[model samples]
Target chain A: MSTPIETDVVIIGAGPVGLFAVFELGLYDLKCHLIDILDRPGGQCAELYPEKPIYDIPAWPEISGQALVDRLMEQIAPFSPEFHFNRMVAGFRKLDNGRFEVETDEGELFHAHAVVIAAGGGSFQPKRPPVPGIDAYEGTSVFYSVRRVEEFRDRDLLIVGGGDSALDWTLNLQPVAKSVTLVHRRPEFRAAPDSVNKMFAMRDEGKVRFEVGQVTGLKGENGQLSAAMVKGPDGEIDIACDRMLPFFGLTMKLGPIADWGLNLHENLVSVDTEKFETSIPGVFAIGDINWYPGKLKLILSGFHEAALMTQAVKRIAHPDQKLVFQYTTSSTSLQKKLGVK
Target chain B: MTKISIVAFDSTRFDVDAENGSTVMENAIRNSVPGIEAECGGACACATCHVYVDDAWSEKVGSPEPMEEDMLDFAFDVRPTSRLSCQIKVRDELDGLVVHVPERQA
Candidate 1:
């Protein structure tokens, strides 16, 4: 294992709020190292609704979730916050000197004076389907997410589930795959009306096949699928397919955060509104992962909390440095620090 | 360039040249105007950039899209003239536009 990453702060979650925390903490001259379970930043925004338009942001009337994340990435560019992606924080403990040490599931360790829990709704993991032997085909013929569209090219793809992901992949993979079959236990879909309608249209046009059933069995050897046993209303039917896409949605768990010895209410970390610090000093919580009176679980609300949290974080990180309230607009020192000159 | 006036909750007003293709949020951040957090960097994902369009310019600023309307529901105080600054684009026709930033965003 590599040496533990030493920094002033270790911010868990690279969502909008966590990314903003980097800017706030950086303003106080604190270096930050961020870790997220997702392979990329933006959390739910990039993972769930990258293209969905949002209208409530204070300045812009409307912006896509992905664009918001991109701009934030740019805004925080000057901070150079380090990110450890595709890793889950597995261990957290207070060091003897009052600093904190955090370890990831990947065995990477991080040491910091302050720890900020910006994880929004915890980590998102795909709900595994109930089909036995499905795990045997995972990473080869069974996938929860379509990382690359070309991977399904020329293959027989059978997509399961009634949500957006199933319908979306059915529609997207229809043209590329040699054959596309969509299977859902219910006729009613929870997907967007537009996408559901388009999927039906494609099915009616013979571009895709629709089956009402649940994948009950997987037929494959060494992770290569040859067929799937589907349980329809009539009976079990076998569908020839090389790939199975199941979109059973995601489950969010507090995970190791709950075991860190912090006070928790309703599976959320409780913190004070002033410093947003949890029961443990040197450890703070913000964003949806934190709960406080009158707390609105909004991205900007987390941003404001991050701003206030950093003041306390600065005191912890560098007790010798005097804290000052300065605006990025007119503070020449801040401007110089940000390399704005 | 067009000129836009952004008034903060304290009634502190800032008049800056608005870039033709930039959104009002961009102009506020560029001028370092307070009260407009633009936390998501103008992404409509958060309500930090909430602003009240001057009554006279409400029609000129136009109405919020359905998606924007859904988001405005989360703003601290929603008003007929409350608009997300990020959604309003700057153009020659929007010159002299004035908006008031809320004391605190949602």
Candidate 2:
């Protein structure tokens, strides 16, 4: 409903490739605004393996995934690309003027001359716990992720699952909650060794309760949870709690990107090797989401594709201008734009 | 340089020379070999670069590592000869490496 944020390009997904695209587009004097489902950028690099060492990056022989992302962020700082985080782009339409308008699930809208999809493996959505009727408590008593930690303060919390998220939050919320109880299908955990050990230490110290069971049912009224039925090895038991946090891990789905009408080859956006442009003329696909002959889903490959796509984007965005390729190493205009002088 | 032959599902043959220490997936991308989509680069993350090693080169190509085998689970078709091209590092012994790429990667 509000006036769409106007920009030269709307880049979906703030992953490493999307971040790099900003720099490439900025070199051509095109402004970019990025949208990501996560609260921060770096997609799989940050989410899955932030501390994992990457060996194949061109210049950097060894850099952690998160460190590489941080460097990219610093590199694009001069561009000042606008970032719209914690929002899922749900709607897209091409305007009569050849511009594209995209609306996020949060109701924010963006109008841009070109759209670049750098969404790595699509959108990551939390896998809901298999408990029946858990939907009623999703936004209220039950939560998949701890957005604001303070919201659990002084409340009776029942955290479930056996992953890093569950153990991490159990340790964090124990000191503040009225009582913190962790429920799992088994005593074992797939979380990090240290966190798992700390959780057991807390349980031994009587600071928290560890119940080996599965959450079978919920007892609440009008979206407020009062208790949860746990199916233990012996029998069912009800644990009183005001809040339940279940860390069931996350699954990546193509989400709204699948509905954008682009040709998809096995859930990946199919694009040409030359321009990285999708079936749609003004739309482009890069990074892990693109499919082409001999397409290597490497960050370096995406970087190469981003460079070529930017050339195409510049032509489409500035049709009247004679596009000249300029090397950043020697181009005074580029150095000035990058503020490297 | 090691000569590598990659055959697509349509039986299109691409013969290229790759430097030692490089990967089959890298050489395929460099030579624009069809049906080789190494989407994760060479990270062994995505199994897009799945290939079936030729019977003669099967033992020479070796078996996919545990990590590569795990990733192979996501590939289109699983066979004893299936290997992730990114994990197949080129070496002097692999001078005449031959592999067949699947129709598509899952």
Candidate 3:
């Protein structure tokens, strides 16, 4: 019901590819707004392996994932692209006038002349533990992330995982929950030592219980959980709890994009290499989320796709404008657009 | 070449002649061994390439390094001998290495 923010292009993912698209699109004076599921821009480069070195990026001998993302951010700064973080594009439809409308999960709408989907792999979603039948309790007695701390008040909570999410939530929710039990596969924790120590201190005081194990089963009725069966070192044991929070980590899923009626090859959107445009007019797919014959899922390939896609996007956004190819090294106009003139 | 055997959850066996310096995960993927997702492509980031080292070879394969150990925390049903196959490089000492793929990856 709210007014949609209008833009020349709405990029679906704020990964390196998407960030580079802003630079390409900006060269032609096209405004852009990027929406990403992550809190920051880097996508997998930030989430999965920020410190890991990436060797394939062109010209750079070696750069860490986070470093590459940082450099891209700097490269796109002149464009002043608007970023919508911690949001997912839930709805997408083409209007009769030939423009596109995208709605986020938070209900914000964006109207754009062209849409670029540079979602690498897909949207990063919280990984669900491999416990059998756990899906039945999702959104009710089981939750992967804590949106509000008040929800667990006076409820028995079982927190699973050895990472920061599990330990942080354990320490934060222990006060509100009637009881809190921290479970992991090993005694060693991957969380910060400070949080792990605080959790252990709480355990020593009998405020919480720390068990080394994995949750193998869940007992509940009609989406309400009562107990969790854990296989610990000693043996199998049942931990009684009404709520469970498992922080396994995150995995990429081809979520709402699959339902947008676009042509899909396997889980990837089919795009033409000429313009990187999908089957849908004025909509494009690039990076790992796109598929073509001999398409390689590399950052450099995505950058090339972005440059090519921008040409087509400019045509859709400004049908009357004459297209001119200019290199940043030679053109004063391009340098001015990049703010280097 | 080191001969490595990767056993899938359903008991499917793939024996690959893994070249030295190549990872066990690479060989499994080359042979199309099912269940070795290796989602992060041997970055030691995602733990989808989880496999249980055959008991006899556990000593020879050695324990996971600290980074791999941290990544294993994301794997499913991790056991004492659980290792990310991507971190296990093929070498002369690891000849005839046998690892069982887990029921599911993280």
In terms of lDDT, the best-performing candidate is 3
After superposition, the stretches of candidate 1 with alpha carbons farther than 4 Å from their true spots are: A1-6, A37-71, A85-88, A104-109, A121-123, A292-304, A318-330, B1-106
**Which order, best to worst by DockQ?**
3, 2, 1
Candidate 2 runs further than 4 Å off: A1-7, A14-20, A35-77, A80-113, A120-125, A133-136, A175-179, A201-207, A220-224, A251-253, A271-276, A279-282, A287-308, A315-332, B1-106
Looking at model 2, give its docking quality level. Answer: incorrect
Q: Which candidate is the best by TM-score?
A: 1
TM-score of 2: 0.56
Distance from true position, residue B11, model 1, in Å?
Answer: 73
Give per-residue CA lDDT, model 3, range A26-124, as digits (tens). Answer: 999999999999999998887655655677888888897789999999999999999999998999998888889999999999999999999988986
- Reference-based lDDT, residue A273, model 2: 89
- On residues B37-78, what C-alpha lDDT tens digit does candidate 3 reach at each position? 987778897899999999999999999999999888888888
- The model with the greater DockQ, 1 or 2, is 2
Interface RMSD of each: 16.3, 10.7, 4.0
Q: Please estimate how well model 1 matches the true structure, expressed as its whole-model Cα lDDT.
A: 0.86
Candidate 2 chain A worst ten-residue window by lDDT: A44-53
- Residue pairs with colliding backbones in model 3 are none
lDDT tens digits by residue: candidate 1, A1-341: 77988899999999999999999998888999999999999998887667666777889799978899999999898989999999999999888988899999999999999999999888966767657788899999998777667889999999987777788778878989999999887576767899999999998999999997767788988899999998887888999999988876554478899889999876679999999999999899999989888878888899999999999999998889888999999999889878996
